[model samples]
Target: NTQVNLGGGEGLAFRNIELGTGLTEFESPEVISLLDASQFRLLNLDEKTSILLTGGAGSGKTTVAIHRICKLCFNKHVLPQDILILVPHHGLVLLSRKILNSIGLDQIKVMTSREWFRNQSLRLLKGIGKEVCQDTPFRVSLLKRHRNMMKVINAYLDTKKLEIVERLKRSAFDDKKIVQFMKETAIIKWMKEIMKGDLSVVQKMLLEQLVEELNDYNAIREEIFKDRKLLKNIMDDQSELITSNVIEETIKHTHKQFLEEFQEEDSREHTLDQKNISFRTPDDVSGTIDLEDYPIMLIISNALNGGTINNGETLKKYRHIVIDEAQEISPMEMMVFGHIIDQERGSFTVAGDLAQKVDPISGFTSWEDALVDLNLSQDLTELKTLEIAYRSPQKIIDLAHHVLGPLAPKRIPISKKHHGGVLRTIGEHEAHILILINERLEKLMEQEPKSSTVIICSSLDSARRYREGLRNLANVRLVEEANFTFKPGVDITTLEQVKGLEFDYVIIPDLDFRNYPVNDYSRRRLHLAMTRAIYQLWILSPSAFSPLIPNE
Candidate 1:
């Protein structure tokens, strides 16, 4: 429809190619050539070094990004390894890799940003000659509390000059389980005092065992001490020492320590011993390190500044980075990526739609805020809004816009004609809804036998329920975070799991108020679900529908 001149005196013509019926059943092979003049401009971008591409679902943002990578690798003579395509979730990696492989750019790295950041950070931390311990918030809190409680207990024993205390200390140090049990008991005591509620079955069992071991008269009748009376006195003293005040003080100290260690902007290293960071009774030590993404970024930043990571050569080379699903990237991640990317060369491209941002905790709220966080000048960075969606049908896009109400922008009309698409709702009894869903799937299979399908639910439990209910169907699998099977067959998964993915047919069960209420998040999620369907969409409910949906 239009001709665009590349900077090198070459011209490329764009034409209308209908996503016509009669494509290969396995994949949408036309995606590589689906870019229009507006989308294709990214491949020949020379006016600006950086670009921020904004578009709704199926707007060809990702397809254009992939093509741009090919352009750089093949046309511009860029190394495949130099290009980084950062997808939001792992589910998108499979398709991206496949696309890259199809075009002979298979060596290019396609990974999640977090995965890349984590690997680089760990390498940098090791290069700095500093021991690093990765830990979870829950385990960190528990470990620190236990450690501080033991400190208090040791200090209490130091003050006691009694011979019984000496024997207890020797016995405790000889048996590590005794000390570990004492540490667990501190957490149990704190829980009982703070919650003031009935303990869980596991906690109650722990408490009951602890009390029986330390407080029971017959429990400490062992022959470890020459005098049973002295051992008994030591047990009674230990019980008294682990009082409410000690537990509270230890917990308070743990909180303060965590705040100082984790919240400090200039924190270099943590004091926790990496060798012994386990709380379970059976394992004395665990080499498990599960650091958060933000903290890893912070460590990488610090390491780079200090000149320790890969001898400061890990990120020294300029990288052409493409960040997909940029809306969900946190400010810190954006900042770190900004620092890592070559600003002058303008080799960075980020594509995302804000309306589909489901991650509230770390997701950016606006493009302005996101740019500010990325440390980029608004005037310099070229902003491209892809108005025409090439993935989903216009009818599906219209339904998505309707669900989003005033928050969504009106889709720009496409001149090329296509099917109106199918949007149907089935309700009433659960049995009836199931029957209707099966019938619809049967009809859809008869029409397009190899069309990809997904049954998205509100929650994981709901997805499991639907997958079980629709078990009679062939090639159906329940998709979760661990097992992400984005295959050709039917996949039943949660809405969050299916982000940045498309299906020929999408079935959303239980479109009721309880699951999808009339809120900003719920409405946006519903919009995202509707837009994922390329040809047809089905909404199933049980005699009740979300008010977010229109009566029509």
Candidate 2:
């Protein structure tokens, strides 16, 4: 069960309704507190609820989600590991992880969509236990364990003194008799025998003693190789001596052959086991199988249907599941999660700001649209809205509202002092605007050297052009969205990449309609770019694009 606190100034108490019944009543608050306190306390534990939080920039949606998660973990007595928080990208996951860490709940793991899928696949494989082999992708119960075991074996073989000595002797040299003698040595034969078998306690003890003797011989050989003059003299003969180039080529070919043999043996061993192996897609039938095609929904369903782990216990112990930046996730991805929720009987909490979505290029739009498309709303019984602006000032918010128009939701009013700074737009003439912007930036730097600023463009070409134009300005750095770092200097970025970030000053160049035509997605992205300015905003564009702005 999840509880939400919609804090503003006014209080409205609303009751939770059943599936058929709508929101019953909007009762007036008995106690009208100055700070609006709206609480959503879940009464039922069995019921699974899906929540959609929609708001523009400055809204306290993120804060509410964080608080909600913390409340569930500490107050509700939910285990930290059970609460899985999903974010859009790796960056947001890190940011959320930092936030959670700061709040003393460091155990909460944040995973991106790709990471989550990988983890789920690993977990499902692990449930099958040692009945499955560790060679093939489908057969391997755990990828890390399989890889680690192979690595250990490889390391052991590579470090074996007898093997190393044999390899060195096998290299072309005048002393063919010495090489043959080394290959037939008793020590080399014993080492091979022990390495081939699953050694017991007694066998391992005997091998350790043999390894010690081998190390001593290895040290002696290494000391001999250390004498550069002796080595040069030994290989001095033109026809009798083996050149270093020939030795290197022989070793490379031998290593490649050895690797091929090892892989073939592994494949043979893996196929010997008669396990019920199946593939999700036909494409994964050959080569390295990608288990990602095995839908998460199916895995979760099987797990819930009395699938036991190695310990013979049912694998259904998670308390809660969280999906952050849910707006960017596709309907198929959400369905995978929805199945997990139904199977595990765990609570689901998805946090995302719909207006901040910018992944349309990859086919994901908004959570609202995704839900409708996926038919996930059939289970969703409650809807909540978080409307608080904690990051920006009122003046900045006002400007954002004016520029964003219909897209900007009503945010909590901030003080005039909190507005921080004003936006100054110079004329759109390239050279003149550049001079004015540079002058203003220089003056601001003089006043506040520590203050940071961002110069944004809608396209990479324009960003490059602006960066090239500003190369003459000393200490004025041009940073692209790809190369964005938290440095106390001027940064130039694009609108798409600058979402979910705030800057002290934002200089928007090439904001003309001709350059960036207004569309539903573009307008939302534009709002995101405009609202990022915490202190100041400078929008430079042609007079033709001026009509887009509301005529005051």
Candidate 3:
């Protein structure tokens, strides 16, 4: 066996170390093959022990994950409600649910982390017999600035009498305040603006665009805040994860905040008193809970503070957890989960590849470190790696390994016989590319009755351009990140949206260097897209090739 690198181009690797054996007691009822012994062994892992499953592209990591989940619930008799399957995005949530439902394993809970976090916040509000409103007593006014988001609060504070500003000066918030600020990435406000020099072209455009969005939402936000009754029912809302406070703070960080100009039924101007405006900006004059009220806060507040609520029933604490795409999980999120997950049971399985981290700034370095942050120690935790490249052919796998550069994991190839797919460069314009894509679609359709094809573009905007011209081609539709259904047809989407998804045949149009340049992130995106094809992959670009993909 050839040794592979683990941390990118460092040329480092460890000896082959096998863990526990595959399960012998349990058997799945589904029609499948136990062809991969390692996968079988991973499924048989001791349920009581926490596990970290790390592997390379095309390895049967997801295959083993779903199978183990079924084995626990269907065969092991674990209560369905006690199991939680967390995915990175909504599309994966749909995919996981479909996988379960196909195996007749309903009742299992599947949700994105953001959805889970939002639900937790909703529970807290319901328990207190309150609601989450944009503004309970009206958010007062909106402020727009370029860099200093906290400036709005400061500006509001400045308008206040000198005595009030003095009281808040240099006042330090609690630990959670710091934690929340970090989570929002709003520290940039207090940190020196890139003002070390003029803003870069990208930075300047991004900040200005943010201001435009803030201005656009002004009227909608104002109308939402005008409902005093809704505002009165509000307790704590989301700060970063879809809570009222989170949006307010984000808009603050961008330095472009806005509120609607409230109008009475009689067409008269409506405004808060001058003193009240000051109170609302920096203080909670409406008594609505600040978004700083997070799920962990609720856990501590309810259990420790002996808080009560009229939510009728309590939110469930999952006894077993399955985190899919665990590589994308941030350090802050892991810290939060460290608190909520049941420590006594400790039946957790996190699945992800460190190398497959397509996006930078993920705050993910290593599973060993995440284990410590997650409070899972070597004494109780076991590791699993499915090094098989089951999804791609030898050519595709080789291309991917090369593109991964130095940070690729020490992946072992287990897939040898299942080879099918073509990776080629078509020198053609968008019009020619569309013709070729349609031709491939016709071939796939003739081969199978209900075949699903996905033509992934560089971005949503690019996808729309393709979609607008080829709308009549085989049930064509744009796939949004929130899309929960997988119909038998063509789907055009972005690189970010297609994670944890596969297709019968895949087409990557607009594969030029201008769109997908030669870089770590773009290369990972290309690698990710390449691996999604179960049977076929066709790359179309105006140029004869892409630097991201080497000439074979």
Q: What residue pairs are clashing in model 1?
A: 1-14, 49-346
lDDT of 3 by residue, 238-298 (tens): 1122245634553343222222332222454346642322223533223232222233234
Off by over 4 Å in 2: 1-35, 39-51, 118-318, 341-345, 361-382, 394-424, 465-487, 542-547
Each model's total of backbone clashes: 2, 3, 10
lDDT of 1 by residue, 1-552 (tens): 011110110000011121222123233346546567766777777623568899878777776676667677776556887777888777777767766776678888888877776666555443221222332344232222221222333333233223323443543323443354344423323323423545455544544453333322111111111222222322333344333443344333333323322322233343466343324332211222332332333422342133223333455434588889998776556766766665666467789997787654443557887777676788777789877676656766766787787667766434121543545565666666667767656555555455577888888987787777778877778888725554556788888867777776777878898888877888889988877776566777885678877776
The candidate with the higher TM-score, 2 or 3, is: 3
Model 1 CA deviation exceeding 4 Å by range: 1-35, 126-307, 310-313, 316-318, 343-346, 410-417, 482-486
**Relative to the true structure, how large is the alpha-carbon lDDT of every model?**
0.57, 0.48, 0.55
TM-score of each: 0.65, 0.52, 0.65
Query: Per-residue lDDT of 456-551 in model 2, one digit per residue for the tens?
Result: 887877777777777765556655523454445577666755655556667776667766566656666666777776555567763344434543
Worst 10 residues of 1 by lDDT: 4-13
How does model 1 score by TM-score?
0.65
Q: List CA RMSD, all candidates.
A: 17.9, 20.8, 16.0
